[model samples]
Target: MTSVAEWYEKNLMLHRFWSVDDSQVHTEYSSLRSIVVSNFEETIKMPINEPAVGKRKSQIQEYVDYYSGAGV
Candidate 1:
C-alpha cells in the first residue's frame, strides 16, 4: 500500500486533471463529487464534496439555500 505522504508527493510531481472523454459522456447525474487533499505530513485529510445535477435541485443549490437561509 502506498503511504499518504508518498501519494501526496506523487500528486505534486505528476499533476494531472481527471476528465471524461466526449464519446463516453452520459446524461445521468452524479449527486456528489469529491476532492481530497492532505497535509505535507499526511496527518490530515480534508475532503470536499460539491453538488452535482439531480432530478429536482443540484447539491450546490442546497448548500446555497442553507447558507443564504432562503429555506427553499
Candidate 2:
C-alpha cells in the first residue's frame, strides 16, 4: 500500500455526500439535500469502491485496487 498519505496527496478533493455537482445550491431547497454541504474536501467519488462495499462498480474502488496491485 502507498499508505493513506500518498493516495490522499495524489487525488484529494472536498465535497459532500449526496450533494449535487453544481457550483452552488439555492436556499429553501438547500436543506432538502440530506448531507452537509460545507467545506468538506477529502471524499473521493472516483476510481472507486471499498472492500467493505464488495466492489459494486465504484470509481474509488478501482483506484484503490489498481494502486494496491501496483504494490504501493
> 1-72, model 1: which lDDT tens digit per residue?
124334644765422223233133323653555445566565665444455555555555577677984222
Question: What residue runs in model 2 are displaced by over 4 Å at the alpha carbon?
Answer: 1-55, 69-72
Off by over 4 Å in 1: 1-30, 58-60, 69-72
Model 1, 15: alpha-carbon shift in Å? 10
The true-structure Cα RMSD of candidate 2 reads: 12.2
Q: Which candidate number has the best TM-score?
A: 1
lDDT of 1 at 60: 57
| Residue 34's lDDT in candidate 2 | 19
Best of the candidates, lDDT = 1
The lowest-lDDT stretch of 10 consecutive residues in candidate 1 is: 14-23
Over 1-72, each residue of candidate 2 has an lDDT whose tens digit, in order, gives 124334444455433334332123223222111123223543434321122233153344466577774222
